[model samples]
Structure formats: structure tokens, C-alpha cells
Target: MDKNELDKRIADLQAERERLTGELDKARTEARDAMIAGQKPGGTAAALAERLSIVDDALAELQDRTRSAADSAERNNRKRRAESALEATSKRSKLAAAVDEALNALASSWDAYADALRKDVGQVSGAGGDLTAVERALTNNRAAEPLVKALIQSGGVKLARTFGIDTPIRERHAISLADAENRVAESLRVELLRVKAESPQPNVSREAQAELEKMETAR
Candidate 1:
């Protein structure tokens, strides 16, 4: 396909993905509201959840297609001059290896402390600010919160600070894009198990029920 056609298709797919995401979000919100209100969700919640899952699958497929199309178009548009320019740019990137090594060290440090940090931050670690800020700071090897900076500097391989209060070694230490995500998933699984145990017989729809089962099996 021509570049213009490929670009248009990518854009259209992205728009559809966004729309589906919004719908899924709305459905989740409604389901949460119902649970908070102590209302027994009839079939609507279950159906909404099923529809959301289907939309999520479609979105994933569309994103893969969009990326493939964009890549093909870029390759089709590449020329000898562009190749030479890219090669020269890569050769001059002296800081690339240093940056990669630094980030790897930070990720390792974070992994060492993942369990403690998860307990301390709770769900906030997965949300905005804390995890995002810490990860960004680590990636650039820039300064972040005093504790995080110290953690990165230590390479997550040794002690950086001591707490007067009694605490476990893991809590006192630090360690990814992938590493960070894995930690979050680890924390989430723990939280989900706790929630499932505490909130037994939750009056949710079949869709939510299925999702809960999936969460249980995530690890």
C-alpha cells in the first residue's frame, strides 16, 4: 500500500482502539459503582465485562496491525540517503551504552527492593507519580527523591541507607521497564489474592468473576 493509505489505516485503527478503551473504562466504572452501592448486578455487568474483554482483544490485534503497517510504510519509504544518515547518527551516539547500563543497574536495584516498596506504596506504586517518576528518574540517571537516588547510586546491589527502626533488608534496598512492570504485577497478584480472600462471594457479574479468576492465575 502507498504511504498515505497506510498512514490513514493506522490512524483509523488507533482511533477505534481509543474508542474501545473508553467504553471499557466506562463499563468498569459502572460496575465498580454498582458494587459500592451494594446492588446485585443482574446480567448487565457480566455482559458489559464480556464486551470489554472482546474490545480489549480487538484493540490488541488492531495495534499490532497498525504497527506492522507503519513499519512496512517506513521501510517502503526508506532510501539510500536515509540509511546513511541513520548509520552516521547511530555511530555518533556515545552515550547510548552508558545510558543502557545505568538503566539496567537501576532496574536491578529496584527489583531487590520490589516487595518492600510494594508494601510501602501499596497501589500508589502502580498508579501515577511514584512509579512513573522513579522509573523516569532511573532511566535518565537523573536525580529523583533522595531515597530513590541513593538506591540507583548503590546499583541495587548493596546498602545505601540504614533505618534506625527495625526493618527487613528488602525494605531498605532498591532495583525496569520490564523489571518495574514485573514488580507491579507481582504486587498486584498479592493484592488480588488478599482481596479475593477478604471479599468472598462478591455479588459481581460473570464477567467480573471470570476476570477475577484470570487474575488469580496471572502468576
Candidate 2:
């Protein structure tokens, strides 16, 4: 059957399963109460026992159906994922090749980059224009970081903005470690809200759509 039909069937079975489970519990309680009252077999006690058996059988059947439906849904999802991955393989390979070429080109200009760094920072007496020393100086100069990044971006045109094969570098607002920690804390709150929305709750304290008005008021 189609996805919508399968989903509806699963949901109906789940609700019935829950109902059967509750009925079974009630039957057991009734049987216990009858026995405590010194009731004999083949009457109220026997009726309750029989009802419990029927409920258990129905619950088991529903459980099997639920599992089969869930497995079918999972298989459909897996097939879709496999198809998407196969489609993207060619793009991924091209991006990988571009990245390798960029690295090789950058490697050839290492000495020239070090010389430029020395010129920008001004040479020290003992450094003696040594390539390693110049490279170290460039690495240690925090001011040169932005310039180096710009150079890499310029040389790697395939990796630039709007290249859909992979994510391109972009400027982002700098935040402190404390700000990052606070963002993670907020993410936890968002996750809690998502879980509450998705979980099936027979009873709820408040309607989520109504509570959403609080967010608007805060804004």
C-alpha cells in the first residue's frame, strides 16, 4: 500500500494496542478482586480471566502488525538515502579533486609566501632571511592570518562561494567561548520543545499553539 495508508494503519493499530493493554490490566485487577472476595471459579473470576486472555491475544497481533509496518517504513527511508548518496558521488569526487589541486598549488608557493611575510613584518637580525624562520614568523603573526586566508580563498576558486559541490567559506560573527556555551544551552531547550511536540501524550498540561503566544510577547 501507499505511505499514507500504511501510516494510518500503523496509527490505528497502535491506538488499539494501547486500548487492549489497558483492558487487559483492568481484567487482571477484576480477577484479583474477585479472588480476594472468595469468589469461586466458572463465574465472575472465570469471565475476567477469559477477557484477559482475549485482550492479550489482540495486543500481540497488533504488536506484530506495528513492527511489520515500522520495518517497511524504515526500508523505504533507507532506499531513499541510498539513492541520494549515489546521485551525489560524482559531485563529491569533483570537489575532492579540486581540493587536492588547490593543496599542490599552495605547496609550490610556500617559500614565496614566507618571503612576503618577512617583508610585511620586517626582518630580524639573527633570522638571516632563513625560510624556516620566516615561516615561523608568519605563523606567529596573528595580523597575517586574515591575509593568508584571503590568499587561499583566491587560489581555490572551485571552493569559492556558490560552489554547490561543498560548503564554501564565509565570514561569520566571532563569539566568545561563553557565548558558544550559551548557544549550546539554548539548543538543549530547543531539543526539549521538539521532543515534547513529537511525542504522543494522552494528556497534556497546555496546548503548544496557545503557549506559542508567550514567544510572540517576548519578541
Candidate 3:
């Protein structure tokens, strides 16, 4: 049965229990009066005992019904909670996955743009700040333009003419774009897990609360 129905039934049963208790008390009073007035009292005593038994049995049955209704309510609540958790998980998973796809696309596009930019500027500083700005532009809109316009705006794209086309810059190997992309990957992984873990519903098991302990020191 539903919670409201169960609650009404419990309230009705409680009222019945109260009525039974009152009847039991009245019966005891009647039996005592019979004994005080010099009547045999045997009949009243016998009836009182029986009424007591009836009240006890009725109370036991009501207690059982109360417990059963409580158990049912708990089961229903659990079913709803599980369904909600599943729905939340699905939504969060999709959001995190979308984030992953978007970042990956940005990285790929940025890598291509960086390659072109590098060639045009003859392997300019492989600074993460430059690529980061480009990556942001890929996601947003870039204020920087190309050739004449860009050159006029940002001074100009200057190259180290001392380095030959075949030679490396300052005798140091060019850093792969993958290195910066790795940093992005690490950042994404943490954010993805955070997205998955952040929930209004309790993720911790009820039983686990007992076993949890405060750490004395870092491992």
C-alpha cells in the first residue's frame, strides 16, 4: 500500500489499541468492584482475564501491521532513490563525455593551427601560454587575425633568421604539442570524475558510515 494509506491505517490501528486499553482498564475496575461488594466475582474475573488476552492479541497484531507498513514504505523509498540515482548517473555521464569530446576536438584543431603558426613564425617559443590562448580562441572567437592585420596589431611575427631551415632553434629540439595536450588531458580527467561524483543523493553506503575513520596522518 502507499504511504498515505499506510499512515491512515496505522492511525486507525493506534486508535483501536487505545480503545482496547480503555476497555481493559474498565474491565479491571468492574472486577474489583464486584469483589468489594461481596459478590462471588468468579464470572467477572474470568471475563476480565479473557478480555486482557484479547487486548494483548489485538495489540500484538497491530504492532506487526505497523512494522510491516514501515518496511513497505522503506522498500518503496529505496526503489525511487535507485531510479533517481540511475537517471542522475546517465545525465552526468553524458555531460562529462560531451566535455571530453569538445576538449579533444579543440586540442586537435589547436594542434593544426599551432603547426601552421609555428611554420609561419619559424618555430617561435613553444610556450604553453601561447597555445592556451589559441585554444581559448578556438573555443571562443579570436581577436587576432592573419598576415597584414595580425602583423599590424601584434607588432609582427618575427623569426630567428640565424637558424637555418634545416636547423633546430638554439640547438634544442622542438617540444611536441602533445606535452600541452597532456596537461589538458589531466585536467579533464579530474573534472570528469568530479562531475560524476557531485550528487545530491547520498553516494556513501549506510553501513559504511560505521566503518569510516578520521586519518591521523597522510599516507
lDDT of 2 by residue, 57-146 (tens): 665765676678789889999999998998899789999899889778756665575575567443332322223222332665343333
Ranking by TM-score: 3, 2, 1
> What lDDT does the true structure give each of the candidates?
0.57, 0.53, 0.52
The Cα error of candidate 1 at residue 68, in Å, is: 3.6
Best candidate, TM-score-wise?
A: 3
Model 1 weakest 10-residue run by lDDT: 160-169
Which stretches of candidate 2 lie above 4 Å from their native place?
Answer: 1-42, 90-219
- Rank candidates by lDDT, best first: 1, 2, 3
What RMSD, rounded to one decimal, does every model reach? 39.6, 30.1, 27.0
For residues 1-219, what per-residue lDDT tens digits would candidate 1 score against the true structure? 555765666576567657766776777777788889998645555665576576567657666776887787678678666989898878767578776787798678766655455565645654422354234433334333434434544544234343222223253444423455565565565555555555546653444556667766974
Stronger candidate by TM-score (2 vs 3): 3
TM-score of 2: 0.30
TM-score versus the correct structure, for each prediction: 0.25, 0.30, 0.44
- 1 or 3, which is superior by lDDT? 1
